[model samples]
Target: MVGEKRFRPDGRKAFREKEEFPMTETPLAARDRRATAAATARALGAALLVLLLTVAAAAAVSALTGCAAEEPTDDGDAAGVATSDADGAIVVASALCSEPYEQATSTNQIGFTVELLRLIGEKSGRGIQFTKAVNHKDAEQNITAGLPEDVAAKVAAGDAGLGASSITTADALEGVVFSDPYLHADFSVLTKMDTGYDDLASIQGDGIVVAVQGDPAIAAWVAENLPAAEVVTFDAGVDALMELSSERAQAAIVDEPRYLRYVQVKEPHLQAVETIASDKDYAFVVAAGNDELLATVNEALAALRADGSYDELCESWFGAAPERGTATRSAGEAVQDSTGA
Candidate 1:
């Protein structure tokens, strides 16, 4: 058959007048056009993907370099820089050489607790000073002399600013308020490795000579728990450790962190076993009357927690951030300082 002629809908001839074009079942020109269109579509898709990846990478970069919402602010003074306040200055009385909490060299003051107090001062524009309390008695004396009111008197009189360097007890909570817990230390019992005492229960009937300093809480706990062992009280935990090293005491019950520090120095052949008791929560004591300062300190502590400073302090000292909890009543216990300054 002759080549079929095509016409437009407007009745104009569609085929060229030069010659009738031959037609095949599938035209190579149409196939080529389709292939070109597909290629163009793929190129466009790849270009769009590249654009998306580039935007995502830029966002990741911003997140890594403190542009994210939770990024830490780097401008705040973190080291132990003194802060000044409206008052002449807030004098912070701290025991100067306690390890894991406060420590100092000939030229530097460093530790988790000291740094925390410094941060608090920076936040409040308050000046803080570290003092050397030779012993618990010295600490108590200094606290007694510095404040116009005594803790017990303040409890009786319902005033604030009467806290001493002591542990908080349920009874004390009745009359005084404790600052945020600055430190939490576990108590452990140390014995000569050769003593064969595997745990606290094993030493119950063994006439274990436990040496401790003036910490009455530890003494009380021992008295109530290890009724069979004879607990010998000393002037300081370090003194007790010295006695144990010299073979004066068969075992020593002391703060776990402090015991770790002591063994490093004395090199005593001792083993430590810890009893999971309530953590020793150390806080600043305030007289019942000075609610203002107590609130201020508590607010400062809250700020420290929000800013990651508190967790940083915890990590520096305890190797982990402390779990936060609600406020509860803890007071009215005997005061003793095992830290020998």
Candidate 2:
């Protein structure tokens, strides 16, 4: 029987003997599996966070860049894209609407600003357009009041355009850029022919009230200079002239061109005496940044003066050629009486 029962040598099972051994699990394997899972999750989270931060950073950069580039700068030199709040029209605004400078019926705006700008437009191959007021004082009021939104708006928005008016003093030169001096206006005090006041000093404190056309700029200067004179105000030059002629006011302050124009037609008894020549340098005021357009306008004005077109316009208005030999004439030189006193 021992020979028949052949058992395995050691711990063997072969239908005669059976042996079992213990299996010990490794702690390192379990730990390694858990660490791998954690690492994968962390990698995913970090990638997602990086994506979110990149997106946010891009958004912040976009926000920092503003819309200023899309709009025209305040200077009138913009030949590029124009701001489109209004229609795409280049509007030229002026202070004169009535006769001599401008009229509803008259086509020539020669002596005044409208014609000069119109000529500039014509030479530039662009039909210069216009928006007119009753007078320079009216235009100034419109500028201050913001009545016509587009013309005033361009100035406010700092676009490449300007309104036609005199840019005379340092204070007036603050907000707008001035063109080359196109004309000079003589300042004078108008009084009834019978009024004995000969000079500014004679009229001061003489109980002789002076009528001034309601131009705050000119009026302010007059007020500062002539402290003793009582100033009466009027809506327009005609009204001021009427006041002086009617003796409602003893005197009125007016420019020589307008005064001479008035004396030629209206009350001949009204005498405009030389108190002080306004010595005005009339210019176009463009949007502050448009130095290029200003330069262009100046260049064109110079050309017009050289070619005799400006002289022709002046001759048409004053019945004589421009004595200054240029479009600009100083008020004092143009209006001084023959006596020079």
Candidate 3:
């Protein structure tokens, strides 16, 4: 009895012997066992098919009905009805967190961003209340209410009315509304004039060093495009720019205005050889469907440009007037302006 072989309904041997001890007959040797195994395999295959179908169905449902994880906002707290024109002041959130920081967010409140908001507010006849960011990277999530779920609905649901600072109107933030471009982000590739590196391509060689602010964007760019080049990062754009020398880093990439305002004024020897991503637009963010307030802001921007205040402010801050033809153009407006149509 101890040595007698046993079998399960699944056609697997049920004997208590160690699997290595061996079986006198293969599981498929017996007719009944073979039939049972085939049936079991069929059943398992059917079950697996059903499971896959269920998972696919669930995925489809989620794709159709599920909203994306909320875009990173400045605040995590739930908001009330966001209104563009409430009796109280509208909250304009500002900040941009940098890399190489232990904190979750940082507040790099550039003065012009706030001042520009104030100007827009004054022009729009709305009382703008400034809300600083706990972290600079924290977008106006508090006001955005996480997008495509409808930004205006959330804004009208809460007091987080607008997002300012150097907020780029990225495609990822598609559902969110953006006003006409007030500023254009032209990242300049700068090098020491003495090096004779007159363009970005001059230093695209092995062992050539490039510097950038601690953001991964530029570092990743160098890694992908300039595989032979080495990249260095710094906490500030100045630190990165400082790396540029004939003996050291061959190039540095930073916001053009930043280099123009802070570095170029003092270090006249450095030159911007080329601009990168000049088409990037910096615009005010509002909730989608908040048309009146958005139009008001856009009109205010146009007025600012028309009255020469925009160029004046740019010159006062960045030391040069913005490229007028580029900034403030909406999508179709650029073409119209270009053709004079």
Candidate 4:
């Protein structure tokens, strides 16, 4: 009866019933197909949510790790010059003072300070660039009482990492820090052979002219120590020496190294007559509160000293290793003598 033709109440001829098929081959109803499609979509949506969450977590972890790796540790590198780049290059300020210590020969800078700085760079694996903060003509013209203000200002402003113009620690101003002394020298008097002045005392008298660098301290010292002698100031030691050579001034006061280089070696007729002050210590000067830079510089200096590089530099520049522990006057005494206090 299920497979036979069935007739409706008003039908002339009813359609025959279709044959049934296996369960696997049976077509699903519209409602059942809709339910199956919805379930598959939900499963796919859950998988996609998991994948997005995993990717987000991985990105967060990577960021945190990168930040940790970039953090600097405490191995004597704490604070640095604000102007320095990531490669650790630094700018050094200097003045063209004298030969064998600091000088501008053509476009290249070659001198004791230049070589020493290069050695430091090699040892520390850092790059160094030098700039002349104090012009030779200007430094020669205006000598200040304390540390040179322009140099101090540059370092304070982060324009320079250090000042290396044969600067003495005694010349340091407020908010400036000086490294340990790498070279020591004395103030001396230079005169022509015919001047017949054997010492500083002999050259002192009324109408006797003395030429000196444009350093207020040095000028003050001359005024206080030699009250009877007339003082003439020049822009630099070389200029002062020139005054003596030209016979414009009977005597010249300069540092020991300059006396040895310019008078003894260059001008054989000039002679160093007397030692005025013997305790000047030449060092690199940095802005105050830059402890990290100071530490690194000291470390490099100590290494140079230990490895005999410092001695080599001294010999190359001065023809011998510099004498250490020499007796000299205190800073106060020196300043007082210069200021006539």
Candidate 5:
């Protein structure tokens, strides 16, 4: 019955009927299925390799960019947030004075106060941003009158952190704090080499014009001590020295380091005559109530002193370390001592 032949009634031709065979795949079809599977696996492998290579490239780029961003900047501070934000920055106000201590031409603020603030920032993990004050007028005014709208007032109002310059302690700054004295300076007389006015007595005579910085205390001292001399006040030491150099004033009275640095060496036409007042102490002024910031600054100063950075700064600026046994007085105490109160 599986393979039988059947005839039609008409009898044209007989047809053979075969049994049905079970379904079996052909060799060509099997080869096609295997080739398709292999091609899919190759495509999947290529996709995974491309994904891994992309991730590796992204990681390498991130590592290189991170290293470049974390490098130290030229200002000696790590490059990061802008200091103007004040979120983690210490904003300092300083008045330009003598060279090497505070230079006008320095891009890095290569002065004593600038370097000191940088060191303090480094120790405290804060960044230093420097602002220029209107000179020592604020300190002088704070000494004479109550705190007017000056740098000290700015510090009191939280507009700035510290006032840096040759700021001394004063009795009138009731809401301000003074740091420990960094430099103990003496007030001295500067005169031309041919003036022949050696001492306060010799310089005090009729028609004698003496130039001094616009500190009321210094002006008062000159007025009280040199009664016979007329005092001319200028807002800056450079201006006062210029007055003496041009023969407009007979003598100029300024701090010792300034005289030694600006006049003695830079301006060779001038010479220091004698030391007048020897008790003035230079320090930074901060807001009174900010004890935490004050403590941080004091700690930094102590570290610098202990590590000899203070001495190095002194030598670089003053050409020698400050004398031993210098009094570390407050602004109020220094003002009282200066005024003999």
Candidate 6:
């Protein structure tokens, strides 16, 4: 048919005339018209390819010469370039060399902080990634101290958003922000079951060695409360408690819930003497000024509890359901210094 548009066998639209032609038009004339159309299409395709190649080469030269581009960080990521997911997923960094709370370095990432990060992502409808460090304090530090420059840049870019670990809500840092506390806990003094070093008073004597986690806050707490005791700090809470097993330390100071589980399940030889009076709240943490991330994580935490997922998780980890999250209470209940949140 004359002037009938058509498509190629490959599904690309072929350049065809839609104009009407006289019935007297001959086959030779039609063939000439088709040949001309084919020639024109080929010319257009060749020009488009050249244009694309020119643009690509310009971009490559500009990148290599550092034209208006930020330098790569020590970690090899561009300082200003975002390493976050294309789908806007956030990363949660942690380094808690501890138990129940951290249990880091495991393939399963079994622990309170890691599981909480997972649930928060699920509830918030956001993708989440976990970045493990050598220890948790460094994880929190990354949110605050501006180390591993790429992460700080990522936070600003909204790619890296959280500092997950057994991060207490207390001790607000300049660059770190806290979500509502998902769990409330008290400090505790744990001792060997047969050591007769059960209470704080028993371990407060001069030369009484108390094993404590390297968390500056807990270490500071031990220093303030037990002046006469020789404080030995371990990199991890589990390691500190292990010192108690060898009589290297008479007592171990740690979060009440973690030690409770440790005593009942992992190490029956340990006893939680008693919980300290002042309570602390464990909360999800984000970089300071990350208002959007903070709000999302808080909402997810509340929903996780309201839907009973928090309870089930607690049962799995602690062997019992836990009390209501301190978020339902006053934020005032948290210690305002290195003590609590």
lDDT of 4 by residue, 1-341 (tens): 23667788896547756566523533457668888999999999999999999999999999987653332112223353532434566567766555557777666888777888888877777876666565344456774322355666667666677777767777746556888887787666677776676456678877888999766667767777788888888767878888888888888887656655564346667766555555678888787888777787889999999999988886676555544322112111111222122
lDDT of 1 by residue, 152-209 (tens): 3332232212233433443244545567776565565666666576455677775677
Provide TM-scores for the models.
0.50, 0.54, 0.55, 0.62, 0.59, 0.59
TM-score of 5: 0.59
Please give the TM-score that candidate 6 achieves against the real structure: 0.59
Go through the candidates in order and give the C-alpha RMSD of each one to the true structure.
19.0, 19.7, 17.8, 18.3, 18.0, 16.9
Per-model C-alpha lDDT, please? 0.55, 0.56, 0.59, 0.68, 0.65, 0.63
- Using lDDT, give the best candidate's number: 4
TM-score head-to-head 3 vs 6, winner? 6
- What's the lDDT for candidate 2? 0.56
Clashes of each: 18, 6, 16, 3, 3, 6
Q: Clashing residue pairs in candidate 5, if any?
A: 101-112, 169-331, 170-331
Question: What is the overall TM-score of model 4 with all chains considered together?
Answer: 0.62
How do these models rank on lDDT, best leading? 4, 5, 6, 3, 2, 1
Off by over 4 Å in 4: 1-80, 83-87, 97-100, 134-147, 172-174, 321-341
lDDT of 6 by residue, 1-341 (tens): 56656799998879856546544658899899999999999999999999999999999998886622222222223443222344555565555445777654545566776777788888878776655433134544543222223333334443445665666666444456677988777566667766777455788789898888766657667778889988888666677777887789898876666765666566767766544544477776566665666788888888988999998887777655544221110111222222233
Consecutive 10-residue window with the lowest summed lDDT within model 1: 326-335
Q: Residue 131, candidate 2: how far off, in angstroms?
A: 4.0
Return the clash pairs for model 2, or none: 74-158, 75-289, 75-290, 76-160, 76-290, 187-278
**Candidate 2: which stretches are off by over 4 Å?**
1-90, 95-111, 132-153, 156-160, 166-175, 194-205, 214-229, 318-341
Error of 1 at 13 (Å): 99
- lDDT string for model 5 (59-115, tens) is 999998765433212222232212223356777655544444564455556676678
Q: Which lDDT tens digits does candidate 3 get at residues 1-341? A: 23557799998898765565455776556877888899999999999999999999999988765322112222333332243333444565443332111112244334666667667778777766544343223465443212222333334344356665555665345435787877775566677766777665787877788888754555655676577878888767767766774347888877666666644245666666555544566677776676666787889899888898888888776666545222221111221122122
Candidate 6 wrongly placed segments (more than 4 Å) = 1-84, 106-108, 133-159, 215-225, 287-290, 321-341
